[model samples]
Target: MTILNGLKILDFCSLLPGPLATMMFADLGAEVIHIESNRRVDLMRIMPPYDEEKESYIHQHLNRSKKSLQLNLKSEEGIEIVKKLVKDYDIIIEGFRPGVMKRLGIDYDTLREINPRLIYCAITGYGQTGPYATRPGHDNNYLSVGGVLNHSRLKDKKPVAMGIQIADIAGGTMHAAIGILAAALHREKSGEGKFIDVSMTDAMFAMNALYGTQYLGSGRPPQPEEEILNGGTFYDYYRTKDGRYFSVGSLEPQFRKLLCEALEIPELIDSTFNDSSYTQQRFKEAVTDAFCTKTFDQWLEIFNEDFHGCVEPVLTFDEACNHPQIQARNMLVDVKKSDGSTQRQIGTALKISGVEPTYQYVGAKMGAHTEEILKTYGYNQKEIEKLKANGVLI
Candidate 1:
């Protein structure tokens, strides 16, 4: 059996974080019913980069292995319907502002009255009670407040923006998933549910454990390019002759010595341990000059031929998508749509020993299972039709 075979989830979230958390559960075999609004469609459904048949690629990828139910939560009848359905679902995840769910009368306090065992998760940019709880922000803002962007700069340059939404995925999505699962485990013993407040800013702060610890213990905050891991040492990226980038991470002494030997710069071997800024600058310049002499492919060949350092060519998105190691790890999967067409997607990263995750299909259309879900909640055909006529369901 799958890991979460009998679990049920009601996901009332849009964009990235909450949907991604519940999508992970759906991949692990949970029955995830995505509660969307007929009045306001999900933003992802209209984002760029359509599929071959002009379907929303974001929707297809993020909402795979889940069902959709479009209902207007503003209507009283719609809120009643959700109240009835919450009695049966094990988890509820929402990504609205701090007081929005309470205003809609569907907050954790209200839902726990109907089903005390409901695991309610709230994902927001800030937490529920902080001064910035109600503030509007995104991934970059959270990263800025959490000290990630500050240490991410290159010497005197502006803080570099990351290609991926690190705060949304790593901070919000990952932490929410972990919190919900932990609450589920606790519920198994206590026979009670819990509320999880996942703040993207808070999660980023938690993930900065290493830097935080250093600062707290030494009473000194890490500056840009001052720490070894943060481009302070030779463990950094260098440009090749072909304008491509290669990464070198010879952090240990033996590996640094091996790397220096391979580069035929034995004089720089002892400089790796010197904390002098001048020595570091000279070593980095020498390494940079050496790398500029070879093309990326040539450097890759040399590294593959028994180089003892942790060096590799920086891969593009397409290259990483088609990489042999990633493919071997089952990081890519194909899901067939209702139209009998298949689309490629990034698969689940989790790999349990005996339980294999399943990708049954791509995302369904908006309101694709609305009538069916209503029927399961004891609404007859005529009542469902009446609700649809009243703009409760569409």
Candidate 2:
């Protein structure tokens, strides 16, 4: 009854990008059989801070609603089994560096032969081809190569490492999902599958967006802290006396007036119209000094006085989870495990009018659905046992 109900995904995607992309499809009601291996499992499964059930909390969040099928890809029997599954499932997501899947005999070129309508996507650091395509890289390396880190820093300071994996999630995950859906639409009309090569570095390069366009249009690279949103105007964060920070984004005239008036420094309002660097610096310093006089909570109380300004405190994650606005949006929910225990999770942001998101369960035990999935693929209990004996499924 969901948007992606008929979509079937044979996913070999592990870790962040590919897994998250398929997870989105699974959440929206697609059939996702997550391919895993006993010999070489996903590293996320072994990461620390496991829950009381001894399951990795991170895995619970990422792999929900997908069925897991353990297979030893190095084995011939495993390759045959995967090809059999591909005949029924039309989409595949793989995250190997390029050439690995081709060597394993299930690359997009090979699978498309089995099912010409198969939509195959590869999410990699660089892509299928380039001098750096085979290079080993992580989120930071991709961002560095993409020129994103160059303009997102304060003057004369090394760019701080990000708390989140922006390149992996925003870059790869989003692009992979978008490309697959776009290809799915193409397949709908032409009845032909497409190969998607999602490069995280390329996505980050595209994310440069307005600043990058400005640089190309004007023949000048954007400097750190020189752009309005970066810190050029007084549109930035300021620390209060209590050491907590408040974000200021009062860029519009009306909001700027409200902010200055809330700070009891209405005189600063007139000069805000000037976009000159010197004037911006003076305004920034004045706002900084004013913020230093009050605690973050005190400033928050003043802003809450119907200021209607786009200023707010730099809340911690826990605060954000508890905020009234977030609560009002019904963002938090309790998803169940088969045993009746439930985990509190941030639910989907998608708000389709006639469809609801599915949370079948938190990440299942490794290969929890192996027998169930195999039976659907025409394997009997005896054959399943033989595969387990051969170390084909674990």
Candidate 3:
């Protein structure tokens, strides 16, 4: 059996963070029921690259292995249906802003009253309680406030935007999933559930732990690209002749010697490599110039065939999916779409030696399980019809 075989999750979320969190649970065999309204589909449904075969790429990744139900939470009957589902579900995740869920009457207090053991997780930009809690924001704004932007700036230029939605997926969604799991484990011991308030901004703040520690203990202000391990001179990206890049990290003396030998730069041997004052800048320029002499592929072949060469050729997104090391580790897998065309979906980063991850279900259409989900919540056909007639189940 999968890890979360019997767990049930009520996913009243839209966009990336919350849905991706519940998707992680569903991947491990949780029964995730996604709630939506016919008035509007989740914004992800229209995001690209559109799947011509299935008609939606959003459904392809985010909605995988989950069922969907249409319900107008503003309606009394609709709220009642959700409460009934709460009695059976072990967890509920909502990604609405701070007060939106409470306004809909499905807040943690309301749900916990019905099923005291329910693990309720609320994901928001700033959190449930804070000066900025109610402020409107997104991933970029949250991470920016928390110094995530500092570590990602150019070497001697202004801060640049991060490549991925670090705050959304890494800070918010991943933390939400972890909170849900922790709450589930806590429920097993305490026999009661608790509320989990996850703040994307707080998570972003935690990302600067090391930097903060440096500032607090030594009074050394955080440097943009000067940190020893933040891909500084000794550990940074180098461009190649073919417009590709290779990341190198020859931090220690032995590794530095090996790099110098590989580059045929014998004069760099016995150099004061660790001194960041003057030598670091020169070393950075030397490394950059050395790498510019060859293509990325040439450097890759040289490094992979050698030991103690702490260097890696940077791979593009498409190339990364099919990289030899990635394929060997099974980090990419083919997931069959609803239309029979298979798409390459990212494999779980977790590796369990004994149990292999399974493909529980493909992504479902929007509100595809309205009738089935309502029936499970003890709604009869006539009652469901009446609710639908009243514009409550749309």
Candidate 4:
């Protein structure tokens, strides 16, 4: 059986973080029902690069293996429908700003009265009670305030905007999933559920473990390009003759010696441990010049010959998607859609023996399963039609 078989989830989340967190559970065979609204469908459903017969690529990718129920939660009948479903769901994840759920009278305190065993997870920007908790913010703003953007700069340039949503995905999505799993385990033991307050900004601070630890112990904040791992030394990216970049991470003394020997620059071995900025700059320039003399492919061949140093080429997106290692590990799979077509999507990273998780299907259309879901809640056809006529079910 699948790992999450028989588990039920009600997802009142939209956008990236909360949807992604619940999608993980759905991937593991949990029955996830997304509470959507026809009047306010998820923005991802309309994002660009849509298939001719399906929703946007973002929705198809992130909402796979989950069902959708379009119900206007603002309506009293809609809220009542959710309360009835809460009694049977094991978890509920919501991404609304603080107090929104409470305003609708469906917050954790209200839902727990219906089902004390329900695990309610709230993902907010700041938190449920912080001064900036109610303030609206996005991934970049959260990263900026959490001290991540400060150290993520070059020698003199400002912090670069990341292509990936680090604060949203890594901070909110991952931490919320972890909290839900931990709470579920706790319920298994104590026979009681708990509320989880996941703050994206607070979670992003944990990513500063190394630099934060150093500053806390020594009271000296890390400057950009002042540490070995943070572009401070020769252990950084270099441009090849083809203008492609290669990553060199020879941090250990032995690995550094190996890289220096491989480059035929044995004199630079002593400078590896030097902390002087001027010396490090000269060392980095020397390595850059050396790497530029060879094409990326040539250097890759040389590194593969005998070097055990952590030196490799920086691959492009297409290269990475079709890389031999990724293919061997089955990191990508084809997900079927309702239109009898398939899309390539990334597969689960977890690889448990005898429990292989497979992609079932892409996201369904809005309200695709509303009637089916309501039937499970004991709503007959007449009741469902009456609710629809009253502008409750979409």
lDDT of 3 at 120: 89
What overall lDDT goes with each candidate model?
0.89, 0.89, 0.81, 0.88
lDDT of 1 at 15: 95
Please report how far candidate 1 places residue 271 from its true position, in Å: 3.2
Q: Candidate 1 residues 1-394, lDDT tens each?
A: 6999878999999999988888899989999999997577788888888876676999988899889998989889989988998988869999999999999999999999999999999999999997999999999999999888888788889987789999999999999999999999999999999999999999888787888899999999988997888888888999999999988898788888878887778998887645698899899989999999989888888888467688877999999998788989999888889888788899999999888887888878888899899888889999999998999985
The C-alpha local distance difference test score for the whole of candidate 1 amounts to: 0.89
Give lDDT: candidate 4, residue 57. 88
Candidate 2, residue 359: the lDDT equals: 85
TM-score of each: 0.97, 0.97, 0.94, 0.96
Error of 3 at 266 (Å): 3.1
In candidate 4, position 321 carries an lDDT of: 92
Which candidate do you rate higher for TM-score, 1 or 4?
1
Q: Which whole-number lDDT from 0 to 100 does residue 278 have in model 4?
A: 88
State, as a TM-score between 0 and 1, how close model 3 is to the true structure.
0.94
Model 3 spans with C-alpha error above 4 angstroms? 271-273, 305-307
For model 2 the local lDDT of residue 244 reads 98
For candidate 2, lDDT tens digit of each residue in 1-394? Answer: 6889999998887788988888889889999989898677798787778988788877887889998888899889999999998888999998998999989999988889999999999999999898998999999999999999978988899998998899999999999999999999999999999999999999999999989999899998999998978887899999999999999999889999988988878888976635688888989999999999999889888878376899988999999999988898778878888699999887787778888899889888889988998898889999999998998885
